[model samples]
Structure formats: C-alpha cells, structure tokens
Target: MSASPHPLHELDPAPAPSVLALVPAPAPVPAVPVVPANRAPRANTPLMRKEHRDNIALFRYQVIRGAADPSLSTRQRGPLVRALALVDHPWPYGGTRRFSRESLDRWIKAWHRDGFDGLKPDERATAPGTDPSILLLAESLKREKPNRTTAQVKRIITETLGQAPSETTLLRHFRAKNISTGARPVATGRFETVASNEIWVGDALHGPRIGGRKTYLFAFLDDHSRMVTTARWAWAEDAIRLSAVLRPALETHGIPEVLYLDNGAAMSDKSLARTCAKLGIKLVHSAPYRPQGRGKIERFFNTVTSQFLGEITVTDTPMLPGTAPEAGSQIGSLEELNTLFTAWVNMVYHHQQHSSTGQTPLTRWEASWEHRTPVRKPLETIRQAFLWSDTRKVSKTGTVSLHSNSYEVDPLLAGTSIELVYDPFDLDGEITVNNNQGIPAGTAKPVDIGRHVHTKVINAVKDNDTATNINTGINYLDLVATRHRQSLSGAPISFADLHDHTTPKNQTQPAVSEEEQP
Candidate 1:
C-alpha cells in the first residue's frame, strides 16, 4: 500500500537535479568585425556619393539665404530658386567629380555670418597684433581725419599710436566700427545766451568783388565777446557747408551753448538741427526779415567791410591818376586770402582786446573755457549731426534721386519711401537713410551727380573763365570808344577823342556792345 515507501527514498529524488549548479549552452551570437577608433562611423561612409552631400548643402544654403532676405518677395524669388537648382545639379554619385553641397553651404553660411570675413578663403587671416586698445586709437584717428584714406588713416594711427596697422587692417577696423565721414548738423532747440561763447552768432557777408567777381564771407562771433572766431570765403552760404567751417571753432573754442543764425537757405539744413541735438547745443533762429537779433555779427561784418575791406584792397591800385583817393586791393588769391585772414585773425583780430571782454578774443575764449565743461559726444552721436533730410522715393534699382543726383540703397528698400539724411559737407556723398519710423536703415555713399555746396575755386572762376583762364575778353578801349561814338553830340571830334575816351568799366559804364555783358 505504501508503494515501496513512495520510491522517493530509493532514488534519492535524483539528487534534486543538482539545484546549486548550472549547465552552460553555446551562444548563437553572429560574428562582429572589430573597427579601429580612427575609422569613421558606418553611417558616414563614402559609399554614398560626395556630390549628394554637396547638392543637399547647396539646397539648404539657398533656402536659408532666401529666408533671411526680407527684400526678396515670393514672386521675386525666381533667381534664388534658379541659382539653387544650378548649384545642386550635379549630386554626388562618386564619379570623377566629387563635390558636396555641404561644403558649398558651409561657405555660404560663413559668409552670411561674417560679411567679407565669411568669404575669406583662409589666406587673408586677421591681424595678429590686434587688441581693444588699437580700436580706441583707430577711433581717435578717425575723429581727426574722418575723410582720410585708409593709408592716411593708418599713417596717422602710426604717428599718434606709435603702432601703425596695414591699410587693410585699418579698413577692417573701420568697417568693424562703422567709421564713416559725414557732415555735422546745425544748432537746434531754444537759443539762450548767458555768457560769451554761450551763444555764437553766425551770418554771411557779401564782400567787395575783386576782378569783377563777388565773394562770400562766413563768420562766427561769440555773442558776448563780439569776437570773430572764424571766417572764410565761399560762393554760397549753405547751412551744411557753413557747419564745416564752424567745426573748428566748436572743437577748439568749445561748443557754444547756443547759436543764432539767419534763415538763409544754407541755415535750414536738417543736419544742422540734428547736429545741435547731438552736441546738446541750442539753435536760435532770428525772426524772419529781422536782422537785429543777429546784428552783432552783421555789425561786425560791417565793421570789417568798412574798416578793412572798404579801406584797403588786397590788390593795391590807384583809384584815379593824381586824385590820391584811397586805393583798393584784391586778396590776391583764395590761398593768399586765407593766409592773410589767418594772420589778421591771430595777430590783429584775436589778439586785439575786445570792447566787451576787455581782453583779447583768444584770452576771453580761454577764460570762458576755463570754467566751461566740454561737451563729450560719441562718434555716432556726432555723426548724427551730419545727417540731412530729404524725402525721396526708391527707384526701380532702389536708388533715391536728390538734387539731380542719385543715391543707392539696399535692395530690400526697393519701392519703399525713404528719408535721406545726408551730410552736404562730405564730398564723398556719404549719407544715413531712415524709414518713417526713424530707424536708421544704414549708411551709404551715393553717386555724386550734383555740384557741391562749397568749392574752393569760387563761383567767379566758373562764371568768368570761358576756359581755364580767368578772363572774359572785354577791352577798355572797345567799351570807351563805343560809348564816345554814341555821345558825339554833333561835335567835330577826331579819332584822338575816341582814344581819350578809353576808360575801364570800373570808371564808367561801357558802351552798349552788340553782345550783352554777363
């Protein structure tokens, strides 16, 4: 009945199948080849065509460039698409040509990131000795010679900083800093004068004509000292051009707290207003047609006219034979005139004691600046002074036409209305353009197709010189003889009388010639 004692005792339960030990079976793992660490991953193997990578890179590049340009409308994106297609035409298939779109994309991406630097083929590396201090030195030199050439700028830097960079290096520095030459602005805001140099009065004077030509005199005088700080000749009195002359006064004598000027066409330049704002100088405009507010300078010029220009002429010639009347002279030439004027200013004008200051203008100016604080302005802030305003429409080529001249803009601004703020003083046609929102789009140099506001040769040369020489071919004898013939008065006058009638146009009006006198 017990069935042989459950048989468990007889077999010993087969030792419980050795529960403490495990039997190992052979693995079914596939064979794997060992790869060296220097080898690339399988996914990056050259089994794929190199051209394929290049094509993809080219496609990506075009897309990215297209998206970044807001000026390129969808309708106008044909060129971009076509360019991409051409660039990606030969996909990498591991043929004789092995090119990758990725490489093209890499270069393009770099260019977008770095401007000219992005295009550097790696041959033109950055300067080795460049430092932040070099930037400061470059900036200082830029302020002094804003219109300097790259070489000139480098020379100045080397002279002043004792370390000159190459022209290319200097240009790179300037481009990085956005250093540009522009005209300074006129004064703006309310005009107030508490002390001398606190307010300077500027005006234009019509000086006596020498050699039958007119000349312009621009002057800036301290309101209190009545001292003429600066004066120079110009054909026309434009506001922006005048500002250039006043710049030295501002830099050397210190900026006046305010300026008083007439409402001449030249004084109404928007750049002048912007300049005053940037420099924190207030501009006061004289009441229209009322010359009293600006009378100080007006009177000073009158005194100059009466005491100097009128009494003496740079070209001394007897007024009339045996009359002994005071002779008049010409300033000789523009250069000679400038030298004389400088001498007169330094030796006679500035050194002379002012009635108001009881000290020389220089002395008074020095004293005034002693207690005065110099206005410090960043180069950008000062650049704002040179900005002038003109409303213009973008042309088909994104150019704006002004004063019979055309200026270019970024392609994105095409068909847009823009306000051009330009420096009239910059002979190079530099300008700052802005949108209606007052955001500066950027600075540009326009193609100058118009006459300059100020030129050294003077208008007389332009008018009188049929060629390069400064003569109009009018003879005194021809004029006097013609006049004498007309006034014969039935008297039996001989050819000798005609000879006696010979006199210059200065002495009397010439006889009416068949041709008109210009």
Candidate 2:
C-alpha cells in the first residue's frame, strides 16, 4: 500500500469558522483575598459605635472569664460555670443579668476563637416588616394570657398578620419589655405558727466523713419555736434513715400538724407519705428548687458546721463540754461523732438564744406548751405508721418474692396482688400480708431465704461499720462434707447391708442369701 500524503495523525481537516464562533468560554471566578488564620475579624464595624462594642465585649468577658482560665481542668470548669450561672451580673443593655451555663460555654468558645473581639455581640439584620406595631401586638397577646407561650404568641401573630417574626425575636422583645411567662413574683413575708408543734420543717445536711465513709445528718426543726425537734447522723440518706430521725421526733415532741419538707428522694418517699397519711399529719413538700421556707433548717445546719463539727476529735475518752480536743486526737468513728453531736446539741445549741426567735430553742419549745397541749400518738400506732410496704402478686404456688427472698402467703391470696408490709431492715422478720383492699390477709413465712434485707439496707450497714472485723476461719462446705463422712463411717457399703443397718434396733434384720452377699 502507498503511503498517505499526510501521516495518519494529521489526516483530519480543521473545523468551520461558524462552529468555532458558536462555543462559549468559561466565566472567570472572583478573587477572595486570603486572611491569615490567626487574624480576627474587626468587631467595631462602621455601623456599631465604639462604646457599644466595648460594653458588649466587657459583659461577655466578665461572664466567661472564670470558666475560661487556661489552667482550669475539665472537672473544674463545670463547677465554675455552675457557680457563675447562679450569680446575677450587670447586663450592658440593662435586663436580667443571669447567664446560663450553655451561654457561658458558647462565650468561652468565642473568646478562644477571636481573643477579645469575638466576644462582641453578633449584629444580625432584622427581618423585613418586623415593626414596633407587630411587637406590640405580640406583647398584647402575651399579656392577654400569661400562660400563653412564645410559640403560641407567634402562632397568634402569624394568623393575624399573615406573617410573623421568629420565636427568638418575639422572646427577645418580650424579655426586654419585662414580660415573662415564668413564675410571677408574689408578695412574700415571714410566716410563723401561733404555737409549737404546728409545723415541722425537715431537711438533710451532707456531713463530714466519719471513718472514711460519708455521713448525712437528717434534722427536723419546729417552725414556730425554731427548736431542733430531732436530728441524727446516719451513714445513708435513704427513707430508712429519715424514718429513724422522724419517728423519735414524733414520739418525743408529739406529732406536728404538718410536716414541711423539700422534694428530696428521701423526703418524698411513699413510705413517708403513707406514714403521714396514717398519722393524720399533713405532708407538704416545698416547690422544687425553691428554698424560701427552709431557711430555719439551713441556718441550723450552718450552726452545726461551725459550732459542733469544728470541735469534734476522736478520743478514747469523751471530751468535756468546754474542753478543746488535743492536737494528736484521731478522726472519730460514726458512733463517737453521733455521741459528740448529741451532747453538743443538748448542752449548747438548744440553750443558745436564736436571733430570729429571741429565745432559746428549748425555752421556746417549753413555753409553747404552757397553754396548749401537743398532739400525741401511741408508740405502737407510730411504729406501725413508719413501716415500709411493697405490692406483689402472689404466684400460682402460693408464694411471693420480696427482694429475691421467697415467702409463702395464704393459699387464698394466690393469683392476687397483695401488699407486703415489713421492716425494710428486717426483711427476714415477720411480713404482714394484706389483700389488695389493704385488709389483713395473713403473715408471710419464709419459704426460700435468698436475702435477709434490702440491697440498700446492706449498703447502709456497710457504710456504718467501715472497719468490719476479720472473718472467723470456718469452711461451711468442708463441715458439710465431714458430716457426710461421719454418717457413712459405720454403715455397710453394700446397698442391702445399708438398708439392714438403717433398720430399727428391735426390728429383725433381713436374712440375706449367700449368693447375694458381697
């Protein structure tokens, strides 16, 4: 074959001018100037005044300064933020100065990003038609019904105006105007009962460590007399410990008409509620997070921390009333701590004149009984009031299980739910079974004992006895094996001989054939 005039690669012809002219070129991209990573954007923009920017930045810095410390560990930051959150600060724009932990965290992050300028408030452009009139209407709607939420107000505005600003915008405006959906301020004044034993304010204080385990002081104060009705230190802060403190108070001081307590798990336990109900004492729990009415008990705790706990020292012999502890004395055990506290409370605190009451707690408590008698309940009735109960459905086998311990109930109670009322600390003791209607059904007898007490009770006991004595060296399984060997010691090995050996002494032995003999 002849070679082509052009090589195979150069054989194609050029395109027409019309085709070349039809193709368009790509558009050019705008150049964005590179800003250094370390450089922060200017916060004092032309629109904002210098004074405004400074004020905003200062407020942010003050709110987050403590939490933003570089040396603070992760664990320390949380407590710092929480403490700051509790405080009220001066706002630059003039309003409620409280900042939430989340807000503080965000401010800290902003400070890290831009040093000082990042802390300045972001100036967001207001959406169109968000005029003062619409805000006024929203405010009116909120004021019309204090219960109406921000979102509900927004919905009402949206329906009326065909378009409404965002909920955040409405909230900001509402907040600035001092209109809030939260609890309204109520007129409050100091209150006291006309006589003692009218109301008892109860609370618990977290006490110092005794023998390496934390202790809690459960106390009740007479609201009228400011007397410490009952107080005791316990290893646990559960309903059982609370009962131990309260039962004695009721017995010694007589029952109060009302029991005022905070909404703690130990305070709000159903057992306590049941106890109060049975005793006809009104149980009232303070609103959650509101401690306005609990100042007396709190003051009592402060006195305890300062006056009593400061002087305690572990000693083989009890310290005299006015004597200070020797420097070398050890930290006391729980029993010693309680002993010292009881002595201090009786001799010192009860006799000291209270600033608010103007009389010693003991004197006030006694004086209140001059004209009126305190309501008293029988010891047996009070004991029955404090017992804890659990509801269980009896199984088909006429048994009920409590804390994994099985107990046999009345056969009639089978296939029915019944209440198991017993001492939480003594689960192995008598458990009174009551029917669904709360009538006495029968007693619950132990069938299979797995646990002798509730799990919490076991923990409390361990907390109380921090230094458990060494176990006595005894192997139960080995003892059982030895008993088995002793039982088999003189018995014949052959099955027939074993049966004959076990026969009564007066009964004639079975005659064995020679073939069958071993």
Candidate 3:
C-alpha cells in the first residue's frame, strides 16, 4: 500500500542550494578599450565578468565593514556571509526568506534522522510524540475547549513548555489515543437519572399552521421534577434558536447533570456536541422514533398541543416591535393570552406537584440542584436547531390543508408557499407559517367545529322525519317505568305522554281516508 500522507511540519527547513557545473579554464583576455569622449569603445566589449567582479568587491567591502564593527557579532555575521554568496543583484538578500535559528535547528535534526526523507515533512505520529505528559496536557485542552485548533493547542503547549510541539506530533499523540482531530463521536445512549431536574429533557414541537401558516414550539421539562423549565415559540429549531430558550432554564435553575433530547438536526450539530463536551454535561439523544425512551418530553408535547396551541390564536405582526413583520403570535393574538400562559408556567406549572413525584418540580429541584448542578449549554450548541423547508400555499379563506384538518394561516400566505423547520415536541412545536418573504404569517389557529350549538341542533331536527322514522323503542321507557318506580317524580317520561296530551277530552267521530281508517 502507498505510504500515509505526511503530517504538518515539526521543523520548517530552508531551501537547498543549487549545484552548478564547473566551467572549462579560459585564457585571460586583454583589457578592452575604454570608452572615451572622442572615440567609441570596442564594438563587442564583454562587460559581464567586469560587473560580476565589481559586485563581489562591493559585497566584500560591506562584509568586512560589518564584521569589523564592534557592535556586530559572529552569530549575526555568519548569515551576512551567506547573503554575500549571491552578489549579482544590488541586494544579495533580495526576495529570499531566511529560517530562524530554532527553525533551522529543527530542520537539521529532521534531516539527520530521516536523510532525504527529511526534505519532505515527517510522518505524523499516531500519538502526541513519545511524551505522555504532553499528551495529558493536550487531552485536558481538548476537554476544556473541543473546538480549539492545532495552532491553538500549540500556543497552549508553548505557554506550558516554552516551546511549541510540531502539529504533526500533537496529531500523532491524539491519534495514538484514538482521538480524531475532527468530529470526535459524542457520548450518547448512556443511561441517565430518572428524577426530574436530575436530567432535563428539551425538544421542539411542530404546531398547526394558522391562516395558511405554520410554527414551532420549544420546551424543556425536568426529568425528576417533571416541571417544565421553559417554553418558547420560534420559527426554527436550530441550535442557536433552542439555546436562547435553554439558557434561561439553565441559569434560572442551576444546571442539570444530563440534558436529554432527540437526534434532530439541531441537536446533532458538531458545534453543539463540542459545547456539551466542554461543559462536562452528558448530552443524550433518543434513538430515532423510539420516543418512548423520552416519555416525559413526549407527554409535555401532547399537553402543549391539547392545552396551549389549541387555545391560542396566532396573529402576524412584527416579530420584534420596530422591525418589519416577524412571527405570528401564539397563545393568542391577544397579549392577555401570552401573559396568562407565562404566568401559569412560572407560578402554577413549576409549583404544581407531579402525580409521579408527589411534589412540585421546583421543590425537588431546590433540594438537589445546587450541588449536582445543571450545565450551561453554549450558544453554539443552540444554533444547530435551525433548518429551511419550503412553505405551502393557503387558500383565499386563510386555511391551509395539512394532514386531514384545515388550519388557519396568516392572510399574507395567500396562495404562496414558505420555508419552515421545527421540533415536533417543543413547547411551541409546530410548522410556523411565514409570509412570502419569510416573516411569520401570524399565529396559526386550528380550524375546528365547536360544541354542538343551536344551529347544529336545529339542522339535525330538520333532517329527521319524526313520524315515519319513529322507533317503537320510544315507548320502552313507559313500560320500564310501570315495571319499576311507582312515584310520578321518579317515573320515566316517554312517548306515552305525547299520545296522552294529543288525545281529545271528549270522543268525537272522525272521518278519514279509507287507507288511514282502521
């Protein structure tokens, strides 16, 4: 097999000198006629050797002067002699870069060790040199700052040892320990604590589109506490997007030992994973579609849909006041609904006792959170949750068809598709609808047939042919009552009452059609 690619330089070497062939001996030429005011010099006067001699003379003069000076030292003069070797140019050192002493020392060391191979970069070590101590330092740096580059590590090495190790050396050291320079696997699938606040699960939930629009909800719930840490609305579920919601959860309540979530695009981002690694908090993701593993967060989403989004009415407006339109409102277009939800979460939900825990999530958190501590997810980890997906058109009536039900989107989405992405289990989970230019269409409203009202009841009555479609069971209540209770108060009312009320007080002879008369 072919040899592996060389690692980055441990020592940068200088360019080798060019070897030139010897010239044959030549007869000395007589001096050429000098050019005079009255006569032109010889037609083909050869001046190349003369110019070369002149340059050599000038360089020698400068070197002698430089060496003779009291301030100049041998260490500085040696490089000047080397510079004098190229004397044809006005400046002998022109256009050439020189290696520092340390750099040259490294180059010489590599050359002696590997011969011609030294001319090429060294093969990277599988581990950081033979020095276990330096490897330990590198490991610590990696743990402390996973995103740090080789150059950064080198700087750190310099700080500790007063010298930088070759990048290749560091790479080899990491490789020996099976540490990859890029994309080290994130630790996942490890078991976590069962108690709330012991591990907090966070996720995104997709909600129905309103007025032909969609939206997303982000939520965090404690594992032991079972209390909702926080919930927010967003158009995307990017890592950065989710971190904004997660930060308050971590800061307000101490840190959670473990943060659990699904292997969504946002959570899988390398930047986020690296952040978690540095924080020493284990980041766990549920196996694809095995949501049962994260039942708590799943239950949270179910409640969010049935109780929160179901009750709200989204209205499109500037996402941030003063800016052009952003996301549509959730909870309700009414600020009152938003305030109510916020209040309920902080005051009621956090304090409410869980059926499983038999204590409020906040109380449990207060007991154990200070010491175990929750991790502060970095901002980079929060940025991965965002992705772009295409939007769809809404009909003139402001309804967009999704799955089976028609949801209300913003008026602006009329006959246009937009882009969107979100977590399906977050507090504000839903495909947030956006306008043509990607602004929130407005909060999505679910299209529903409300409780049976007067009109529906009247319509049902009109559709029924009472007399012809009457069931004989209509009289069963009268028979049951006679067989059971004797009191009028407890007796069952039946069709018998209809007949008794309709009967005339006095009997009268009635003529009817032959078919009707019996």
The candidate maximizing lDDT is 2
Global lDDT of each model?
0.51, 0.66, 0.46
Model 2, 1-518: lDDT tens digits are 65343211121233344432332332342322333435534433445455566667876776676667665544445556666889897554443468876788788778877898998777556564578899998897677556556765665465446788998888888876789757323323288888998999988899776546678888888888887787777777888667756765675567899999999999999999999999999999999888887777877776666445533443435558998544211445665455445545664566678777799988888898898888988767877787788999999999999998999999998899999988766778889999999899989999888887777556554443333232222221122223333222122221122112132121111110111111
TM-score (C-alpha) between model 1 and the true structure = 0.45
lDDT of 1: 0.51
Sort order, TM-score high to low:
2, 1, 3
Using all chains and alpha carbons, the TM-scores for the candidates as numbered come to: 0.45, 0.50, 0.32
Query: Candidate 2, overall lDDT?
Result: 0.66
RMSD of 3: 31.4
Number of the top TM-score candidate: 2
Which stretches in model 3 have alpha-carbon errors above 4 Å?
Answer: 1-197, 210-212, 315-340, 369-518
Q: Give the TM-score of candidate 2.
A: 0.50
| Candidate 1 off by > 4 Å | 1-193, 314-330, 376-384, 395-399, 403-415, 423-431, 443-518
Which structure is stronger by lDDT: 1 or 2? 2
Which parts of model 2 are misplaced by more than 4 Å?
A: 1-189, 313-330, 462-518
